[model samples]
Target chain A: MNLREVGLRDGLQLEAPIPLAAKLDILDAVAATGVRRVEVTSFVSPAAVPALADAEQLAAELGRWPDLAFSALVAGRGGARRAVAAGMADLEYVISASDGHSLANARRTTDEAVAAVPDIAKLAHDSGGRLEAILAVAWDCPFDGRTAVSRIVDLARRAVDLGADELCFGDTIGTTVPGRVTELLGRVREACPDVELGVHFHNTRGSGLACVLAALQAGITKIDASAGGLGGCPFAPGASGNIATEEVVYLLEESGVDTGVDLGKVLEAAAVVERAVGHELPSNLFRAGGPNRPRGRG
Target chain B: MNLREVGLRDGLQLEAPIPLAAKLDILDAVAATGVRRVEVTSFVSPAAVPALADAEQLAAELGRWPDLAFSALVAGRGGARRAVAAGMADLEYVISASDGHSLANARRTTDEAVAAVPDIAKLAHDSGGRLEAILAVAWDCPFDGRTAVSRIVDLARRAVDLGADELCFGDTIGTTVPGRVTELLGRVREACPDVELGVHFHNTRGSGLACVLAALQAGITKIDASAGGLGGCPFAPGASGNIATEEVVYLLEESGVDTGVDLGKVLEAAAVVERAVGHELPSNLFRAGGPNRPRGRG
Candidate 1:
């Protein structure tokens, strides 16, 4: 399984103002864990999400490792171009499928965001970095209720048609279940068989792992998760925490799905985040001390 | 989507010594919520679990309501006999599928526990109460590891042949996923076409709702849940919090699975337990304030 760590970008984006040194240190530490992909930061305006303003500084200090894919979230052509200039080799852009969230979150409509995807993809491609488009709230929008399956399918087609290397669907509201996941996957795969399908699940409803299980059953191999389940939507009130990365590995490995991630290392990264964020992570694996921790004898 | 609230028996068993009057109050409050079934208490020895020592006393004062079935967990023949004397109409006897958990949790081997099911069922039948056998650690055991699918299937057969009216699979250690649930159900259903199947899931891994989703997809109608995600295995370290009753209803209802449980009423009942337990319930629905709570105008 290809597990992408999104704690730095999506997770930290919701957290308190983290120091730049801590960001670089955390990014370097995460790279050491052998999870090939990490969404390092967002190239958006610092005023909106000040935590990730040091995207350039963090990417500049991002240590190189064999087969590591360092990526950043690019909101539009400006962020995409900035990411290219920042020495990033992979880029991911966010586009909410729900127009209401698109406006509430980004001050843009769904169509406006979709229109920007192609130009962002062009900039990423022209700058020699592969681009992936994340359909935020693809399954549900906290402001608009559930997003339609047909809507996501159409967006997948449009994103791919514009030259996205991958099309990632996100249950931004964390209200998705297996039925919804299976429903979306069946339609999306049929519509865009050539696209690499991925999903981002939040543990808000405690259905994160279930959604992952559903996605895995539907043959999705790429997943975006936060170490210690650290990410949440800032715009969506009460929407906190993504599916923990260790949880994804735990569920997959427990079910004999090889995630190729060391759970202990992930837990260690989680501990680092706990210290950086000054709070305990909400991840079950983080709190439970994992399955293989030594138990004290009475 | 039949939800059996188990806060009194399974949840309170792990909590601090809640007062008998408080227990009775919570039971009555939960009953008023229109939930069809509630596992009122356990008939185990007071020395073993002093919290539920007032089982018979509470049973005597149980408020009657139309179509409400109050049940109790009976450890063995003695407990079953005690429940019969107490006027319980439904009795669920627990047997661990994993040998280690069985010995550690109940001081018996798997076969010894299975052998006792016959007499217990006979006692239940003689007293005009139906019997159900719950295979604890049916999917995974903390003392042991994952309980083999075959083990639970064989236990299901023996319990049914011994006169159990229903067989319930329990994720005693909170280590089950949808894949494991689906695997166990397909084989259990095939082996016992005449018996009813149920499951008890804990949210220890945050996959409780997912496990319920899988079970429902596999045609399981009866589920055991604790109100407010209470309950934990005393012997299993870090295994705390069962699947929340309201979460089960919320998940099912959101997906069109009619639970016949009023979300508003369940939340009201959760509040009563929260005050009695002296802590805010950790259920998603409880914390999220339900799907219809008023949003701020600001």
Candidate 2:
């Protein structure tokens, strides 16, 4: 199983600013944890999310770990230009399935976002970078109650047709259950057998790992996790904590699923984020190993 | 799907002293939530765990809710004697598959505990009561790393042979994922086709509800949950928070499974438990409805 460490970009998107030095340090530490891929930074405007204002600086300095595959989130053609100019090879474009969420997220409707992907993908490909489309709120929309599974499948089809090398379904609000994961991801996988499908889940309902299991059973291999369960969904208020990478590793490995991630190193990286964030992270396995843990089996 | 509310028994067993009056009030409120069954109290010795010392008092007073079926945890012959004496009809006799946990919990070896179940069942039956055997640590044990699936099945068969009316598998450590759950529970159901099987899970590893879905898919109808996700496994120290009543009902009902539980009333009961425990409970849906929630899809 492949877990993309999104603790830095998607994680810090909602967090207070961490110094550039600290961000790089966490990036280096996360790479050291044997996470082969890391979503380094989102190339959105700094004014929109000031915390990740160091995206350009991070992409510049992050050439330090050439062995680690790095990816960034780009909003549109302009953001794609910045990411390609920054010498990043993998770029992720974002859109929402529902028009309400699409407007709130990108100030455009779902049709507009889909219509723009071809140009964005062509621009990225012209610059020698691979583009993948992330369908945010694919399962549950913050504005709309439940996003239709067919809508997500249509987006997957459209994204793949528009040169999306891969497709990722983001449960931005963390409200997805196993059955929905099976239903939606199953359809997406069926519609696009050659395309790679990934799942991004939040642990607000505490079913994140379970949703991961359902996704895996449905043949999804790529999952997005934060190092210390860091990150919150601003839309789904009080809905914070992506599934921790360490917790995901524990669940997968213990269930006889081979995940190349080193759990011990993931914990160390979690510690660094905990200290940097200046608060306890919401990871279950992270706290289970801390001083607050009573004597017994984990 | 039938949810057995374990908040009053399995939940309070690990908490600080809760006055008998408060326990009865919570029990009344829990019944008001439309839960058909409630594992109200344990018949263990009062000296062992003082938190549940009022079990006999609760059972004596709880005859008020005859419309709601009640069950209790009975350790051995003595506990069964007391349960039958209290006119409690449904008794859950427990033994761990791992000798270490059995000794730590009841000061008896696993085999010794199993050997005593027939007598306990006979006593309960002779007194017009039905007895069920819960195989604790059926999946994972704190002291023992991995409990063999064959050993759990053998125990289930033995318990059934000893006139046990039903079989329940307890994930006392909350570590069982969906695969193991499907595999082990599937085997148990096959090996004991005549026996009704139940599953009890903790949310320690955050796979509780997923395990529930897997179990239901495997034909299990009985589950144990605590209101507000309260309660920690005393043996599995870090294993706090059982799958919450409201959360389970929401998941099941949303997926088109009939749970027969009132979600609105469960939240009300959760509020009462939150106030009595003097701390916020660990349920996600419970907090989602509070001040922390933002306007969006559930």
Candidate 3:
């Protein structure tokens, strides 16, 4: 059970502007949890994601944690180059399977996003940074409605051909069910057997954990979770972002999966982000601790 | 697959008061969905559930839908009597398997709730009403924390011995995962072979649907859902209510299970409730629509 903490990025994206110091503090706490993969920030311009305006600064500061696998979201080729130049350990490039969200959010069609993967991959690889191609809105698109398995499979093939190291299918709008996750992951597995597959889900419609379970059953090993279920879908109206990291870690650890994460530590870090954002984060595990989690009783 | 729509009662319980006419209209729209079972309202004190204060009015009006299996929640012996006297076709008697939640929420211990089941069952039977005893807080207790499965099995046996026609286990706080649901349902099946099992899951922790899928695999045929994902657990802090009916219907229908519901009509009703509620409900199919659902080429 490999877990990627998405708090600094996804959690921050959902809130108002935070000081650059606060972002660094979140990174420092995340490092304390020993989470290897952390999506620190997006390389989009300040105009796009104003919260991530300090992406360059945070990336430079994150250099101190040399052993960590720090990633930055790259929406396009330009962002990919900027993120690579900023000394990111990995680049996560997103392409929506749904044309509506693709065109609306990324301002590029699925084909266009797929078309940029090779260049983006080259940009990351040239800088000694790994690249992961994410098929966002892979489950259901608010504009086009439900995305077909064939479309996701085709996109996975295209990204793999473009030298992507990993393929991730995202329930970008919280529109996926367990069965759909199972079916789509099965197709992605058969079509791109050699590539690593990751699962990203939102808890907007309350199917995030269900989708994660289905993905795990379908042989997916990587998952992305926000610290406090923070981020909202930029494309889908009223859609919340990724599942909470504390909740996901609690679920994984309690199920006897070796997540190598101390859920209590994750909850503590979640509290830090929760306080910095000045709002209650949407993670249940943080509010309701685990079965064996130490309360004041002990 | 059996889908019990709980929108009329559970859906309206948590929010600001909608008018009784609006409640009737919602129930009217739900009646058109061809759902075989519908939990209409609870006969609790109006002070406790202001949203469901017009329970008698709703029950009187619901007589027009003779084809639907309309049920009412009965918290105690008096609530059971009121539901039966109102001519409800089915009665749901809720008791907490955990001593803490039962004492805090229902003002009774587990032993006391178990003792009242026989009287409630008799009252329902005398009025020609079917009975289903729900073991709430079956997964975990809000006040006492983790509950033992053996205690839940003992409660199930007692409920069954009291002439209860069916048994339902609730993931009251969304604490149940797929593995736990599988184990609990399997134990219930072994202990009470003659009783039909229903799984009630809250999406609070985002594991409701996963637990539902596990229950289905464990041979539980009856599942409960609310329209628009309404209601929150009073025992479990910050917990969301039951799974969304539209999402569940979508999942079942797409997987070739016969839920005997009109998917489009349910979505229409969901839209009506979404408008009535004055906020966006957390139902994916209500917003995204299923892959096979026709929305006039968009």
Candidate 4:
């Protein structure tokens, strides 16, 4: 299974600004977990998201982990060009499925966002980078209420047609339940059977990990998570950070699913993130520790 | 689906002592959620658990919500008598599935605990109460390691034969995953097809709600949760609170399973719990709020 670590990018985006050196340290810790992929940072405007303004410098440091596949999140054609120019071979282009979220997040309608995907995908492909179209707000939109599964299906088809090498559904607000996860994933899989699929969930409403369980049962292999459960959508209301990578590792490894990521190393990375963020994280595993260690009276 | 709120009893057991008046206020908030059953408090020696030393005083106030069925946790025949005397018609008799936790929690071996069950059952039955044998540490025991399925199956049979009207498996250390949940529940259901089965999970490992999803999929309807996700076992090492009640209600109701709980009311109860405990609780829903209302920029 491919567990992508997005803490350095998504998680740090919502937190207080840490120095580039601190982010590199976090990257080293995340890479040490043996995870195959890491979303190094996002190629957004420095003025818009100051927390991730050092995307180019961060991308330049990616050569230290040749064994790891690193990706950057891009919002538009300009961000895609910047990411590819910085030598990032993998890129994730996000398009909110709902018009409300799209306008709030990207300053455009969902139709305009869809129209921009092809240009961004071409830019990524032209620069020898693979594009993953992340359909944010795929499950529920804070402004639009419950997202229509048919809308997500249509977006999945469009993304696949637009030269996206991979597709991921983002439960932006973490309101998705298992049944909805299964149903939506099943529909998308049927619509784009040949496309590689993944899921991004928030622990906002506490159904994040449960949705992962449902997705795993639905035959999904790629999962996007953050160290220490950091990062919430600045645009999506009532949202929290992505599911904790350590928690997901604990869940999968204990259930006999090999994620190839070391749980202890992930916990170490979470500790590093917690310190860097200057506060506690939302990860239960980070607080409770792993199962093997003795705790409480036992 | 019966979602039994255990915040007042199990949730408060691990926190600093709150006055009886504060507990009644929380109880009123909980009852307003429209949940049908609640584990009011545990009937134990005051010296052993000073936090719940006022179990009798709290039980005396149960008459305020005659529409709600109330249950109390009992460790032995004495506790059972006290609970019955306090007028709780629903009694949960807890016995650890593993001898390690059994000795730490009940000061007896599993055999001795099983032997004492018939007497406790008779006490509950003679007083017109139903007995639910809660098998604590039924999944992984912090002291004993992973509990064998055969051991749980054997205990389930004995508890049913000993006159338990219902059986509940407690993931005492919150180590159980979804596959194990389905497998264990399937085995127990096969062994005790005639008896009602339930589950008690802590979010220690962040698998609690995922485990709840698995149990619901396996057709196990009775779930144990705590408001604000409060509580942890003092005896079980590395344990956390039961799955948060509002989170479960959000998961269930959003997934089309009618828990008959008002999510807003449960969140109110969680707010009351947070204040009484003088700290933020572990519930994600409590922090993020529900799906409605505008949040963030959206």
Tens-digit lDDT track of model 4 for B187-242: 99999998999998888878888999899889999999988788775333223667
* B202-274 per-residue lDDT for model 3 (tens digits): 7665566777778888988899987766666333333365678876776676556788888787877887787
Candidate 3 lDDT by residue in tens digits, A256-291:
677887766777787788678776555555544543
Q: Looking at model 3 chain A, which ten-residue stretch has the lowest summed lDDT?
A: A289-298
Docking quality level of the chain pair in candidate 2: acceptable
What is the C-alpha local distance difference test score of each model? Answer: 0.79, 0.81, 0.76, 0.84
Tens-place lDDT digits, model 1, residues B13-81: 866778887886787777777788888899998997888898998788765554678889988989988
RMSD for all candidates, in order, please.
3.4, 3.0, 4.7, 2.5
Please write out the lDDT profile of model 4 over residues A21-128, one tens digit for every residue: 898889889889989888888999898878889888888888888888988998888888888889987889888888989888999998888888788888878878
The top-ranked prediction according to TM-score is 4
Off by over 4 Å in 4: A233-239, A294-298, B233-239, B293-298
- lDDT per residue (tens digit) for residues A87-121 in model 1: 88678998889898889878899889989877888
| lDDT, model 4, position B273 | 85
TM-score of chain A of each: 0.94, 0.95, 0.93, 0.95
lDDT of 3 at B251: 65
* Ten contiguous residues with the weakest lDDT in model 2 chain B: B289-298
